[model samples]
Target: MIRHAVLAATCAMALFAGAHDGLNRWTQDAVLPPLLHETSVEVRARGGELLRAFPVEDGRWRLATRIADVDPTYIEALLAYEDKRFFQHRGVDARALIRASWQALWNGRIVSGGSTLTMQVARLLENGRTGSWSGKLRQMQLALALEQRLSKEEILTLYLTHAPFGGNLEGVRAASYAYFGKGPKRLTPAQIALLVTLPQAPEARRPDRGARVAQAARDAALERLEEAGVFHSEATSAARRTAVSSSLKPFPATAFHTTERARLEQPEQAQILLTLDAGLQNRLESLAASHLNRLEPNVTIALMVADHTSGEILASVGSAAEIDDTARKAYIDMTRATRSPGSALKPLVYAMAFDLGLAHPETLIKDAPVRFGTYTPSNFDGQFRGEIKLREALQLSLNIPVVSLLERIGPERFMQRLERAGLQPQLQGSKAGLAVGLGGVGLSLHDLVTLYASFAQHGRAVTLSQYAPQPTSGQRVTASAAAWQVGEILSSAPLENAQLNHGIAFKTGTSYGYRDNWALGYDGRYVVGVWVGRADGTPMQQAFARSTAAPLLAQVFQYVAPQIAPLAPPPPETLIVSNAQLPQPLQRFETRDALKRADASRPDIVFPPSGARLAADPELPLILKLRGGTPPYAVFANGEIKALGLHSREASLGPMTQGFFELSVVDAEGRATRASIEIR
Candidate 1:
C-alpha cells in the first residue's frame, strides 16, 4: 500500500506539471527555443547596450547610479531574499514542491511556492503564468533544456542578469539599482533580504508604498534567515522592526532634460565634461541658502554663476526651495525668469555708447534732470550733480547720464548693441524713451550676465552655458580698445565701489520698487550674477542690488579669490583720454617751485612763463601745500606716466611732478580725485 501511495503521488505530480505546461501555452506562445534564446543577436546586443546606456528621460535616468558604478550590499540583499536556496537547487526542487503541495492540501488553498530560481527563469522566458497542461509541459521542457545547454552557474547568472523589478527595469542588476538605488554587490544583509521578498509580488511588496503585506513577507524572509543560522537575534529583531523606505521619486522621463534629448537616440556617444563644478555648486548653495531663508513666505530667489571666459556655470541656485525626494522642479528659475532690470540695464546702455565712440568713463555729463520732448529723466535720489564724470555717474547709479548716453547711442541702435552683446531682446522693435535706460526692457539675470561677460572678456560676446561640452570661442562685440574701456568702467564704478574691498568687479541692479535686484560682474575672470527677491510680483521695499546682492557676491569672491591668480589692470597706454589738455590749475602750480612754504588757506596760483620750458628732466622741488582737511596730489606726464609724488615731504605729493609737472590731486576722503597737467 505504501509503494502504491508513493507511485500515486509521483503520477499526480507528473499530471500537475503537464497541466501547468498546457496552461502556460494558452497564455503565452510556447515556442521551441523560448523567447530569450530565440532572440536575434542584434536584439540581445541592443538590450545589453540599453541596459548599459541607462538613458535619462525628462529628469530621470532609467536607473540610479553612483560614481563607484556599483554597490555590493544591494546585490547581497537581493540574493538573500529572491533565491536563498538558488545554489542548492538544480532545475527544480521536488522535495520542496511536495512539502508546499502538502501544505496547500492541508490548508485547502494555494498558499505556498516551490519554484526554484531556474524554474522562475523558465517561466519568464516562456512568458506569463499559465496553468494549462501545455504551459506546464513547455516550462518543464524549457527548464530541462536550459539545464543541459548551460551550467548551473550560467543558469543562475542568466536569472540574476535578467529579472524584472520595476518599470522598464530588467535583470537583478537593473532592478537592484532601479528600486534601491544601489548595486546588488553593495547591498547590506537587511537590504538584500528586503529585495528577496519583492519578486513574489513586486507591487504588493513595494518598499516605497508602506505595504503591510510586504513588511510581513520581509519579516518572514528574516525568520528564514534566522532559521538558517545566518542572522543573530539582534539582527533578526532589527530587520523585523525596520520600516520600509519611502523615497521613490520618479526621475523625469522627457527629452528636454538633457543634451541627449536634443539629439535622436543613437549608438555611439562621447563623454561630456560640464562647466558645473561640484565644489562651486556646493559653495553657491551655501550662499543662496542664507538669502533664501531671509525671503518672505511665497517668495523665491534665482541665481547663477558662470565662468566668463569658458562660459561654464560655476554654480547655480535656481530657487529657494530645498530639493526633496518628491520632485526636482522649481517654480522660479532666475536663470530664465525675465523682468525689467531697472538700473541694472544701465551698464549695457553705457557699454553701447562706449562702443559707438560716443562716450568715455571720464566723459563729463550733467546728472541734472533732462527733458527730451515731454520725457524728463529723474535721478534715483530725486536730485542730480551739475557735472560728473561718466564713472561717477555710474558709481552713484545716477539715471540721467545713462539716459543721455542712451539717446546719444540711439534707442534702436542701443537695442541692437544689446543683442550683439549676447542679450536676447524680447521687444519686437524699438520704443523711444528715457525709461528704457532705467531698466525698461524685460530681461533675466542670465541675460544681464551674458551681456556683462562681453565687457568682462574684453568685448567678446559668447554664448552663455550652464554646462560646458568643450571650449568655444565667442564673437567680438567691439574693438579691443572699446572693450577695455567697458571693463575699466565696470571695474571702477558701481562694481568697484561695491567689491573693490574684496578685489572684485561687480554691478548692482534693482527693478523699480525692489521687485528684483541683481548684481553681476567679473574680476578679470569668473562672471557671477545674482537676482534677489521673490518669483511672485510682490515688491521688496528698496531692495537695492548693491545692498542686497553685492555683499554675498563679495563673500563668494573672498572665498574663491585666494585660489585664483590676481588680476592685473590693462597697460596704462590702453587708457585714452581726450579733451585732455593740461588744466590751468596744474599749469599755475608748475611755476611755483620755490613757493613750497605757502600757507594752507590759499596758495598763490602762478602761471609758467609762456613757452619757458623747464628742463626736460627738471630738478625743481614743488611744494605741496595741504590743509588739515584737504588731500595732496601726484602729477603725471602726458597723462600716461606717473610722476613721483615725493612722499618724504610733509605733504603727500613730492617733487616728482617736476618732469612736465601735472598735478593729480586726490581728496582726503579718497572718493574723488582731480588731475591737472600742462601739455609739453
Candidate 2:
C-alpha cells in the first residue's frame, strides 16, 4: 500500500511538468492572423482596423500609403505614452497586472487597463472586441505567443496598421496624413504627440475642431514630451506657442460619405478613385444649398456632370445632406433613386425619324392635335399653331409634331435609337405612346446625360464613369445617320435668356408639374444634367425658365465654356428654314387623291407622230406633242389616245387607268420647257 501511494505521487509530478512545457511551446509559436482573411472575425477585425486607419466613415478607404510611411518620432511618442516599459517587460507585464489588480480591488472597480499593445492586438486576433473574462484569458494567452514569435518592430508595424485613430481611419499612417494632411514623416512634434494621445481619445481630438483643439492637443503633447525628456527646452516652448487651427476647408460632405462607407464594408480591396472634381463639387453643393433654402423645405437636388468626350464624371452631387453611418447602413441611397425625365426625351424622337429616312430638319408637320389609336398629345400651352417648320416645332418645343414624327419612325425603332444612344432602360421595347415625346420615359439623370453626351460628342457614345480610373463599359451607340440628325437639333436651340452666353444646346423637361423637373443640355465640351423634385412624389409647379434649372445650367455653361471648343457646325444635311419656305395650302389636300381626281376628268390623248421630225436642239420642245383637243377616249391626229408623255417617250392619255399626261423638255440653258397637246 505504501509503494502504490509513492508511485501515484511520482506520476502526478510528471504530468504537471509536461503540462507546463506544453504551455511554454504554445507561447513560443503564435503569430497574428494573416493580413488578409476570409473569416467573419478577420473581416470585422480588419474593418475595425481600417476604420482606425484612413479618412473614412464606412468602408471607403482613400488612403494611398501604409504604416511604413509614418514618422519614427510619432512611433516613439505612441510607444512611450501608451506603453512605457514596453521593451523591458515580458508579454504578460506581471508587475503592471498586479498593480492594476490591487487598484481594482481597493476601488472595487476596474479603473485602469493593464493590457499592453500586444494584448490589444491579441484581443482582436482571438476574440475581437468581446468583453468576457474567457475572451480576456484567450487574449492574454495569444498576446504572450505573439510577443514570443514576432520581434518588437513587427509587433509595432502590426499595431500601426490596425490601430483606429477616429472616424473610419485605421493605423498611424492613415491617421497621420488624414488628420494633418501630411505624411507621418512630416508630423511636427505637436502633431506626433496629438497622434499618441488619439489612441486614448479619438472623439475629443477630431480634426474638424480646427486649430483650437489642435492647439490644446499640441500643448498637452509638449508637456508630455517635457516629462519624457524627448524634447529640448526650445522645442517644447515652440510647440506650446504654436496656434492650433480648428477649421478645415469644407469638402463636399455627401460623396465623401459614400467613399468612406464603401472602404469600410466592401470585401474587394480594389481601391476606388472618384471622378469628382473637388472644387466643382463644392460649387454645385453651394448652388443647391442656396436654391433649396429659397424653395420648399423638403426639396432635394441631385446634379451630375460629365465630360462629353470621355464620359468621365467631372462632378457629381448625390445629395445636399451628408450621408452618415445610419444612412449608409439603411441604404437611403440618393444616387440610385429613379426619377422621371421631363421633356428631355424629345431629341431622340427626331433622331430616329432621320435615321429611318422619313424626315429632315426642314420637314414640315402641323403642330395641331391629331388622334392616333386613342392617344392625343398636346403642346405645353394646350393650343395649336396651324403649320410650323420642323425646326420651328423643335425650337419652340411644340409637342404634337414630335409625337407625329415618332409615329412615322415606329415605337420599336425609336426605343432602338435610345438603346443605341447608351441608355439602359429598366424596361425596353414597351409601347411608346404619344407621351414619350414629352419626356414620358422614366429615366435617371445618369441615363439622360449619357444619351445627351452621345449627341454632344457628334454621335460617339463615351461610356459614363462615376468613379476614377474611367470604366470602358459604354457600348458604342448612335448610328451615323441618327447622330447627325440629333446634333443639328441641339446646336440650333434658342436661348430665351441672354445671360446664357455659351453656345448651349439643351432640352428642358417637366413631368406634369414638379414630380420631376429636368434641364439637360450640353455645350461643345460638357454635358450637364440637373434634376429637381421632392424625394416623395410631388410636382415642381415652376416652369422650365431662367429662374429654375435653366439658370443652373447657364451658370455651369458660363463657367466651363472656355475649356471646350465652340459649338460645331450642324451636320451638312441639316437645313435652316423659315415659315416662308414652308408653304401651307388654304385647305389641306391629299396629294394622292388630287392626282386621282385629275386623272378621271381630263382624258385627252396624244402621241408622237409615227415618224415625227426630231429637233436637233436638245433644248427645243418636240413639235405635234398633240393635235385634236377632245374628250376621254379621243385620240390625236397622230393616232394615239394620249398626249406625248413628259419626256416625249411615253403617252399619258392611253387609258382611264393611264391618267392624264404632259411633256417636259430640257433647254440648253438648263431651264425646263413644257408643250401643250390635243386629242382627236
Task: State residue 244's C-alpha deviation in candidate 1, in Å.
Answer: 4.1
> Lowest summed lDDT over 10 consecutive residues: which window, candidate 1?
38-47
lDDT of 2 by residue, 1-680 (tens): 23322332333243244577786875666555664312111111111222112334356333433346677677677766667767876565655555555666667665445667887767645537524444555666677777777777777666776665666566665566566654576678777777776766566676665556656766776787778877777887877776654533322133443455455555455444455565576677677656766555566666777887777776666665444423222223344466667567878777666555556666666777577768877888889998766666777777888888777666667666677667765443457665666766667778888888887776666678755445544554554556655665665665454243446777777777767677777877788887666667565566453356666766665555445456666566543444334222211211232334543433222334222223343344334332222221222322333342233323333222222234333322333333333222
Superposed by TM-score, candidate 1 places the C-alpha of residue 214 at a distance from the truth, in angstroms, of: 4.6
Task: State, as a TM-score between 0 and 1, how close model 2 is to the true structure.
Answer: 0.63
In candidate 1, what are the lDDT values of residues 608-653, reduced to their tens digit?
3222244332454444333222334343334543433332223323
What is the lDDT of every predicted structure here? 0.57, 0.58
**Model 1 global lDDT (CA atoms, 0 to 1):** 0.57
lDDT of 1 at 623: 43
TM-score on alpha carbons, each prediction = 0.62, 0.63
Q: Best candidate, lDDT-wise?
A: 2
- TM-score of candidate 1 versus the correct structure, residues matched by position: 0.62
